[model samples]
Structure formats: structure tokens, C-alpha cells
Target: MSGNQGSFSLFQEILADQTQEINDLRQYITNQEQQLNTMKERLMRIRIAVLMNESVLRPFFRVPPRQRDPSYYPVIDMDLEAIEWMQANNIGGQQNAIRRFEAIYGMNLRKCKILVRTAPEEIVEAMNQRAELHYSPCYRRSLRDNSKIKRMKLICSEIIKLWEDCQSAAYPSDQIMVKRSNLERLLNEFWDGQGKKTEWFGKRKVNLSGNKVV
Candidate 1:
């Protein structure tokens, strides 16, 4: 009977020791969870601070407002093709063509002249495609986001959509022209309807006269 009692007491002690160990483990786990949460909060605060600093510093780092490409100015020889097209379409002179091209594609006078003078049909086509995509409605209206990388990705996606539209068209030239009109319409609507909200994209301002990438 005494041996039985001793065994029972030993077992009770073992069980108590295990329960205490478990309680200690639970307490350690709770402290670790609290520490992890605190670290996460600190990380979030650091992220917010970094973003705030970027927002404050962005204007200073912005690319200076676009200027005309120096080499292409003066437009020495008139682009015969542009002149011919203008005559056919009753569009008038070189100045008028420049204005029309700028209004439609946001191209500068010199760039338009260069496009008109480009010898290779394929090169001209490629240039037009690039301009159309860069000035697409979706691109112009794109807003800034928290991630600059994601913002660039979104812009590229919009440009791809423009490319797809051009590729899928029955007549790529006509589709490109239509897209140009759409670009003008969308830009006008953004500027007129949204007030300064359109400036957030900065592309319109950055590429005001030509193809300078911001």
C-alpha cells in the first residue's frame, strides 16, 4: 500500500511538471507573437515614412519640362510628301501640317517634318505606331500609384492595348488615324473635364512638344 502511494505521488509530480512546462511554452509563444506584431507595425510605419518622403521630394527630381530637340529645328527642306498630302486633303501649308500633326499626335513641327521626310515606309509606320501608343488615351489618363514600378507596368499595358488595336484592324493606317482622333478627343476631355487632374500623369507635359521620355 505504501509503495502504491509512492508511485501515485511520483506520477502526480511528473504530470504537474509537464503542465508547468506547457504553461511556460504558451507564455513564450504569446510573447513572441506580440514581438512579431510589433515588428510588423514598425515596418508599416517605415514604409509610410518612405512614401511620404518620396512624395515630398518628387517635384525636385522630376525631369525638367521638355524642350525642342535642337538638331531637328529650322526644317530646311519642305517635306514634299507632307506638302502633297496637305494639298490633296486641302490642309494648306507646312505650318498648317505641323499644327495638325501636333494637335492629333502631339508631335512637334520638326518631328512631323522628319516623319514626312523619312525614306523608308516601314520606318515611318513604326514611328507612327510608337507615337500612337505613347499618346494613347489610356496612357494619357493613367494616374500615379504607390509603386512607380507598377505605374510603369500599367502604362506599358495600355501601350500594348493600343498596339493590339492597331494590329487587329482591317486597315492599320485608317485605324491609326482613328486612334489619333481618339487620343485628341480623350486628351481634350481630360484637360477640359478634369481640370488639373490630368497633370498627374505628367507625360502630356513631359512630351509636350516631342518624343522625350519622362
Candidate 2:
């Protein structure tokens, strides 16, 4: 129809899709883990029996036993310290997944790092091991593909809740941790690129009324 109508329709579709996706991810984050673990346990029991029979059970009656693989989702029993730390850093229990992945593979998941999954500091001296074999890194581009700018705001708000929940959480502590300038930079990063460039916006300001020049 009209240009404004088309824009509205596109916005509506995006909102609907995002809401559904968030709900699905929240459920998957909460559930499906148990299903994967159960499947893996059952598979292990069947695997032993299949190996003993040596397979070749003469085609007709012998069908390959169904085997389920464990989902790559991080299965972890986080330490109390890690739980505290994760809750300290990330709210809604999402950081646990990140910490578990870090514990196993030694990855750095800070925002600036762009979410690289690397191994922990357990360097072994093995001559036979290939240099690359001992160390592997994977990058998930999901960091830059954040669902929306609002999510970042929500994360900061939730983190503030956690700090408030803590015994020693206070303004001075965070003052040392994050500078005011840094938060200003964070705002700039999110608000930027959407509006016109501010680099040379007021470069040519004219002094019409006063004798002001810079």
C-alpha cells in the first residue's frame, strides 16, 4: 500500500518474531538439558551391548540400535565460587552456561573479546601433541548479533540487582570497576551508527551574535 504502512508491517513482523524466539530460547535454556542428558545415559548402556554382539546380526532381524548423542550444551556442576561469581557478573543464570564453557575450554567471553572459546590454563608438556592440537579456539559471532539494544540495558539493570543482593556491593566498589566515561562510551557504541555521524557536525559553527571562535 503506502510507504508508512509497509514500514509498520515490517516492524510488526520483527517484533513478533523476536518475542517468539526469546520465549523459545528461555524454555530451551531451562528445559531440553535434562532430555539430552537422559538420552546420552540410555545410549551408553545400549552401546556396550551393541559392541559385545559385534554388530553383524544378519541384516533381516537385526536393525541398528538407535543411539543418541549428548547435546553439546555445557553440562556442568559449577562450584559455589563460580556460581557466586557468575551471579555477580551475569543475572538470570545465563552466565552459568558461559562459565561452564570457560571452565572446560578456558575461553574469554568478555564483550570486547567477541566471545572466543578457548582452553583453560592447563598447559601440558607433550612432545607428541601437535601445537594446534593442544590449543583450539572458536568464535561465535552471536555477540555482535545481539537481539536488540534494549537487551544490553536489561543486562545492566539485572547486574545492578545482583550487586544490590550482595553483602559488600556498593557504589565505591563499582566506581573502581567501571568508570563513568566507560558507560558513556557504551552508550555511544549502541546509539551510534543509527544517527548521522557526529564527527564533523559542529565543526563549522558560526559566531553570529558573539565574538566566539574556536
Candidate 3:
């Protein structure tokens, strides 16, 4: 009976030590997981910063023609000449300017409004620069086709339809606020559909939709 009791005590001691070791291993695993997550988050932030810097510096770098989508046309012609003329003539009020632009360019009300509201001179200068680049020998040889431009026009028409729908649903008292909210919701939904969430990284409470909360 004495021997059996001593063996039982020894077994208990061994079991206790095994349990402690198991607990220690679990804690170590948890710590490792946490450290890995921290490292991943830091890497993600670094990657985002790199991408942003690249986008900002992209225009300054001459991308090889082979890397560029030859069929891709980025500039949308908004009748820059008409906009420049309006700006030069001191187009007074927003409404007046939109109306005058519409008349001058035979553009629809929506296009007229968009052009009048935006920085027309900057748009003109950017378009001119892009045109020069497009006419360059390397670009001209690669992007001689107009099929992509035609497709883009169709896409633009669809976008215009969506814009008009947003406009029609917006409240007159707070048109911009309502429209912006609706657009942000749509964008969030799009991201969600793609199995992603829209994330904003900033010190301020600014969202991906450019909305700031105090």
C-alpha cells in the first residue's frame, strides 16, 4: 500500500509538469501569432506608402511602352477650348457658365455643369501634355488603334446614366451631401462584393470617400 501511494504521487507530479508545459507552449504560440500579425500590418502599411509614392511620381517617370496598355486612353475630351473661352470671358455665375458652355459646345447639361465646376485650365494643360506624349513615335506606334477609345465612350455613357440617377434621387436642399453619401455607400458595397473592405488610414477620421468626421 505504501509503494502504490508513492507511485501515485509521482504520476501526479509528472502530470502537473506536463500540464504546465502545455500551457506554456500555448502561451508561446499566442505570442508568436501576435508578433506575426504586427509584422504583417507593418508590411502592409509600408506597401501602401510605396504604392502611393509611385502614383505621385508616375507622371515624372517615362514608363516603357511595353509596360503601358497600348489600347488604354486615359484622357476624356471635355471641349477644353470652349471652357478656356468661357473662363477668359469671365463667365460670372455657375449656372450662367454652365448654360453658356452648353450653348457653345452643344454639350448636354450634365457635361456642361461638370466642366464649368472643374479646373478647366488645368484640364486643358494636362490634355495637351498627354496629346504630345500620345503623338510621340513610341506611343503612336503602339496605340494606333481606336477600339479602346470607342469602348471607353460606351463606359462613360453608362457612368453618365448612373450620375443622372444619383442626381435625380438627391435632395435639392442638400444635393451634394446626399449624392456624396449615396456614392460612398455604393463604393462600399462594390468593395464588399469584391470580398474586400474599404479602409482609410489617417490620423483624422477621414474615410475612403473623402468624408471627414470631427
Best by TM-score: 1
User: lDDT tens digits, residues 1-214, model 2?
Assistant: 6999999999999999999999999899768888876765554333222222323222311221122122211222222223334456453444544453344333333521321122111111010011111121111222342443334334333333343355354434354234323433443443343224333212222121232121
**Worst ten in a row by lDDT for model 1:** 69-78
Whole-model Cα lDDT of every candidate shown, in order: 0.44, 0.34, 0.41
Candidate 1 global CA lDDT score: 0.44
TM-score of each: 0.29, 0.19, 0.27
Rank by TM-score, descending? Answer: 1, 3, 2
Model 1 pairs in collision? none
Clashing pairs in 3: none
To one decimal, what is the Cα RMSD in angstroms of model 3 from the true structure?
19.6
Candidate 3 wrong stretches, greater than 4 Å: 55-214
Please give the range of 10 consecutive residues that has the lowest summed lDDT in model 3. Answer: 197-206
Identify the leading candidate in terms of lDDT: 1
State the local distance difference test value for candidate 3. Answer: 0.41
Between candidates 1 and 2, the one scoring higher on TM-score is 1
lDDT of 3 by residue, 94-195 (tens): 344344334433455566457446523332233322332333332233243344333323333333344445554642324434433443444343324323
* Candidate 1 lDDT tens digits, 11-95: 9999999999999999999999999978655543332232223242234324332442222111212223434444565643446
Report the Cα RMSD per candidate: 23.0, 24.2, 19.6
